[model samples]
Target: MTIELSVLVEEADRFLDAARIQDYCPNGLQVQGRPQVRRIVSGVTASQALLDAAVAAEADAVLVHHGYFWKGENPCVVGMKQRRLKTLLGHDISLLAYHLPLDLHPEVGNNVQLGRQLGLTIEGPLEPGNPRSIVLVGAPAEPMAPADFARHVGAVLGREPLLVEGDRPIRRIAWCTGGAQGYIDQAIAAGVDAYLTGEVSEQTVHSARENGITFIAAGHHATERYGVQALGRYLAERFGIEHQFIDCPNPA
Candidate 1:
């Protein structure tokens, strides 16, 4: 079944409320293709490989969390960007991307789904009293050891995370996916036992150790894989369209 591209974007914007959120990039319909979308291929990033996979799948639209035209990125579409756009335009595949909005969604977001996998519900935002707090804090039914929690993360994401141990067992955990190590201070201020994010910086270790908070640098790609999939599933179900998640692995 085919759904209008505008309709898809409309529903997405309604759910994500992109207009309300302050994002680095445009949140919806980055590139237009065929008006009617029948098949959608979703992925973590809108890279060349993902575009190729979408083309191979005969997809009418490509939905992704990471899209082109970032805040500081070179806007001139000459080399890699040119090639990627050429492929999509050649095949008439729409590029639908969501950045911060995807992460902040309550139900089908990366952090939310990650919490679901670990049997935790979002109790509060890490930056409490803030309307748009990206870092979230939650606790499971029972607290587990920091090492055991790291194992659980590895098991769920299918990649071992780099661990920075804390002083005590993890009771309350805070997390934000996709290179959000800078939020370690916020987590520490929140007084959580552990902090989890995608990428880690050199200073993140020192911060974690000094603050006595466990830190886990789970694979960014792995941690971020679920939100786009969840959105794709929702789109498929809502619009009666075919959707497939094409995972192109990136260790970093």
Candidate 2:
């Protein structure tokens, strides 16, 4: 069964609760396209490559974790931005993006998915009081040595995660998907033995060592691929629409 673009957009917006937060870019329907959507494509970003791939796939709509018009980005749609928008417009492909919402979703979110893949049971958010906190705290279902856990992350993510092991076993772990090294402090405050995120900055190394918390810099694209993929699969199964994930690699 096929669903209208409007209907799918509404469903995705409702699932992500896009109206609840002030995001960097428009959370839903960044670009308008055909009314009916039979094939849906998903990707990490709405770059030229991804948009071209979606167009090539004859996708009616493209869903993504990153989209055009970031919060602090220039509003003018020029240069690369213009090309990206042009591709979507020329193809009549609707663009739907979910940023923070995708990261924070309880069941299918990146953080939760990563934790589940690593056999971790989430205890709570890393931030004490923020219900929408991006950082999360959890414990392994069974204790694993720090090196072993690192190996597990590497194996599942298909990339060797950068490991900064502290002199402690990894029982309590904290994580935030996608370049959230700034949350290292929050993880430390949560009393977690280790903190994991997609990308790490230079200061993150020093901070981890000083704070006595182990840190792992998994690839940003690698870590975040799960949430959007899970969401697309869920939409496919529930709504009976064709869904495909277009992988555009980003090392950082």
Candidate 3:
């Protein structure tokens, strides 16, 4: 079953509420292609490898969490950027991407999906009364020691996470997926036992140590893989179109 590209893009934007959120990059339809869409390839990033895979799969469109045209990126389209755009334009494949919206979304967001994978029962947002709050507070099914929790995260994400153990076992914890280590202070203020995010900065370790809250730095790419896959499945189920999620693994 094929749907028009415009219809697909419109529904995706509306579903994610993309226009309302302020993000580093545009949220939807970064590249436009064929008028009719039958297949979509979803991934965490719009890397050249993923684009190549999508082309090989004969995808009509590409969906991702990361797309081109960042706020501070060089506007010139001469080198790598040109190559990536050329691939999509050459093959007539549309690119649709969502960033903060995909993280803040209640159902298929990255944070929610990561919590589900970790067996966490989310209590609420880390920052209450903020509509765009991406950090979330939740508790695992059982309280776990920092080491045990780190092992569990490694098993689930297929990558050994960096752990800074605190004074106590993790009971209430806060998490935000993908390079949100800056939110540790906020999580600490929330009085949680631990904080988890995709990347860890140098200062993050000190903050966790001083505050006596366990900190886990799961890989950025590892943690964000699920949201795009979930969104792809949702669109596939909704529109009765073929959707494939290709993982071009990133070690970071």
Candidate 4:
């Protein structure tokens, strides 16, 4: 089955509620392609490798969590950027990306999906009464020691997460996927026993140590691989089109 590029884009944007959220980059349809799409390829990021794979797979559209043109990126289309855009334009493949919206989604969201994978029962947002709060608070099925929880995360994500052990077992925890170490303080304030995110800074260790909160830095790429796949499945089921998720694995 095939659907119009514009229709697919519109449905995706509406489904994610992309317009209402403020994000670092545009949320949908970063590149224009052919009038119609029969196959869509989804990935965690739209790296050159993923794009190449999409092209090889004969995908009409590439859907990803990370796309081009961030808020502070250089506007010039030269070097790497030139090649990426050229590849898309040359093959007439559309680019559909969602950042915060994908994370904030209730059903197929990264956070919610991550929690589900790790057997965490979601409580609520870390910040009460804030619609834009990406940090979510949850609890594991059973209270686990920091080391045990870290091992579980490693097994699930297939990457050994960096763990900063705390004094107490993790009862309540907070998390936001993909480079959200900055939310530790907010999680701490939320009175969670642990905090988890992708990519940890030097200071994150100190915060966890002093505050007695277990911390886990799961790999950014590993933690975020699910949301885009879930979104792709949803789109495929809705529009009766083919969808494939290609993982161009990144150790980071």
Model 1 per-residue lDDT tens digits across residues 1-252: 899999998998888888999888988999999999999999999999999999999999999999988899888989999999999999888999999998988889888877887787688677667778888899867888889989988998899999999989888889999999999998888789999999999999999988888999997898899999999999999999999999998999
Score residue 158 of candidate 1 by CA lDDT: 90
Worst 10 residues of 2 by lDDT: 124-133
Per-model TM values vs. the true structure: 0.97, 0.96, 0.99, 0.99
lDDT of 1 at 72: 90
| lDDT tens per residue, model 3, 1-252 | 999998899999999999999999999999999999999999999999999999999999999999999998899998889999999999999999999999999999999999999999999898789998999999999999999999999999999999999999999999999999999999998899999999999999999999899999998999999999999999989899999999998989
lDDT of 4 by residue, 1-252 (tens): 999999999999999999999999999999999999999999999999999999999999999999999999999999999999999999999999999999999999999989888999999888779999998999999999999999999999999999999999999999999999999998888889999998999999999999999999998998899899999999999999999999999988
- When summed lDDT is taken over every stretch of 10 residues in candidate 4, the lowest stretch is 123-132
Models, CA RMSD each: 1.0, 1.3, 0.6, 0.7
For all candidates in order, the CA lDDT equals: 0.91, 0.87, 0.95, 0.95
Model 3 deviation from the true structure expressed as Cα RMSD, one decimal place: 0.6
Once fitted onto the true fold, the runs of candidate 2 whose alpha carbons sit more than 4 angstroms away are none
Candidate 3 overall lDDT versus native: 0.95
lDDT, residue 185, model 4: 94
lDDT at 208, model 4:
97
